[model samples]
Target: AQSVTQPDIHITVSEGASLELRCNYSYGATPYLFWYVQSPGQGLQLLLKYFSGDTLVQGIKGFEAEFKRSQSSFNLRKPSVHWSDAAEYFCAVGHGSGNTGKLIFGQGTTLQVKP
Candidate 1:
């Protein structure tokens, strides 16, 4: 079965420190990779995505993700963190089919920013 796992349930980073959220997927073929961020009392926002072509894809809010086929990982990274960046991050995988909206989400990782 295809699934996504976010090893860390919670992560803390300094306000100006770099951040990386790990995401690994188990699938027979290369699936669509996506990263979403949801703030308190808000809907999920698309951070970045990898849908073929480029291994490294740039996303909104100074975020970027690299797709590694060998490791079956699509990790999200940021050079610097902000207080407003603190939110729940989710890694999702979508099987290439009729609907791209259908995705399997990971448990989710909550990011806490320190002063």
Candidate 2:
């Protein structure tokens, strides 16, 4: 079965610090990976995605992620953290091609920033 795992439930970082959120997935074939952010009481917004081609992908809000096929991981990273970046981050995998756009998401990682 395809699944996603976010080991860290919460992360705290000071403003201007670098941040990294881990994500791992298990699937039988090449998977479409994605990262999304959800502010408190808000809907999820796409942060980044990996479909094919380059292993490193850049995203909005100064975010980037690298797809590692060997490790089955797609970790999200930010060089500098800001208070506004504090939100719940989710890593997800899309179902194989030819199917509806259904995604299996990780538990989620909450990010907290201190000023």
Candidate 3:
């Protein structure tokens, strides 16, 4: 079955530290990959997405991800994490053809920022 997996269920990082969240997808073809962040009470926000073209895609909030077709992975990265970055991060893959806007999301990774 095709699904998304976030190896780490939770992660703790100090403020100003670099962060990297791993995301792997199992699929027949290269599907649309996305990274979303959900704050305490805020809705899910799109951090970045990769469809085609450049492998390294830049996103909002100083976030970026690289699409590795060979490994079927789209890892999210940040140079420095702020306290406000504490929240839940999800990795999702969009359906192909018939299902246009539908997305299959991973369990999610909880981020705990340490001051």
Candidate 4:
């Protein structure tokens, strides 16, 4: 069985402050990982993914994450926050055997931006 979780359902921060989004997962085997961001009523844009090797991964929009096998976590972080960064973030795991894409997503984390 495989499952993904975002520990924080919501996060709020003032502009220019740093940001962090926590994500945890449980998988019977090594899982395919992914992070995606979604703006209001829009499709998800892939931020980054970790399949194997290089525990630390860099992403677009000045974001990065570290994959901890032992901890079963992939946490996203940004040195500074912006009002435009305010949106929903999702963490996912894919164990697709034959299907094209089968991603189990976290409920979602909403970000509140204070200008």
Candidate 5:
């Protein structure tokens, strides 16, 4: 059972609000957790990744995530949600694309922001 699941299909929040996107993975060995954001007509950008070391990992664009082995979850959270944060977020796992990075996208979560 190797796959990635994002519980939230979509999320809406007012500007300057807190945000959290749930992600759970099923994999053996050390899982490589990753969070990415995509804008209109743009490619996916790496928000952050959890390979080894610290359980709590920090990412770019003022984002952070914690890897909980007990819960088998890696949830992304932001202290404040900005208008620009409104985009599609996806949780993926792996290191390569061919079959290694062979990520299993969780449908996808759309984040809407209100001014």
Candidate 6:
């Protein structure tokens, strides 16, 4: 079965510090990976995605991720952390062809920023 894992349940960082959120996936074939952020009581917002081609992808809000096929990982990173960036981050994998836009998401990583 296809699945996504976010080992860290929570992370804390000071403002201006660098941040990294880990994500791993298990699938039989190449997977479409995505990173989304959700604020309290709000819908998810796409941060970045990797459908194909380049291994390194840039996203909104100064975020970036690299797709590693060998490790089956697509980790999200930010060079500088902002208080507004504090939210719940999720890593999801698409069901591939034949499926709608449904995605299997990881448990989620909660990011806390200190001023």
Better of 3 and 4 by TM-score: 3
Tens-place lDDT per residue, model 1, 1-115, is 8789999999999999999999999977669999999999999999988889989999999999999999999999999999999999999999787666689999999999999
- Steric clashes per prediction: 0, 0, 0, 0, 1, 0
lDDT of 3 by residue, 2-94 (tens): 899999999999999999999999987669999999998899999998888999999999999999999999999999999999999999998
Candidate 4's C-alpha lDDT?
Answer: 0.90
Which residue pairs does candidate 6 place in steric collision? Answer: none
Which has the higher TM-score value, candidate number 1 or candidate number 2?
A: 2
Instruction: Give the C-alpha lDDT of model 6.
Output: 0.96
Query: In angstroms, how far off is 19's CA in candidate 4?
Result: 0.9
Q: Give the root-mean-square deviation of each candidate in angstroms.
A: 1.3, 0.9, 1.0, 1.4, 2.0, 0.9
Q: List, residue by residue over 1-115, the lDDT tens digit for candidate 6.
A: 8899999999999999999999999988788999999999999999999999999999999999999999999999999999999999999999568778789999999999999
Against the reference, the lDDT scores of all candidates come to 0.94, 0.96, 0.94, 0.90, 0.89, 0.96
Kindly give the stretch of ten consecutive residues in candidate 2 with the minimal lDDT sum: 94-103
- The list of candidate 4 runs beyond 4 A from truth reads 96-100
Model 1 residue-pair collision total: 0
Which residue pairs in model 5 clash with each other? Answer: 96-101
TM-score to native of every candidate shown: 0.95, 0.96, 0.95, 0.93, 0.91, 0.96
Question: Which scores greater on TM-score, model 1 or model 6?
Answer: 6
Query: Which candidate model has the greater lDDT, 1 or 5?
Result: 1
Q: Which consecutive 10 residues in model 6 have the weakest lDDT in total?
A: 94-103
Estimate the TM-score for candidate 1: 0.95
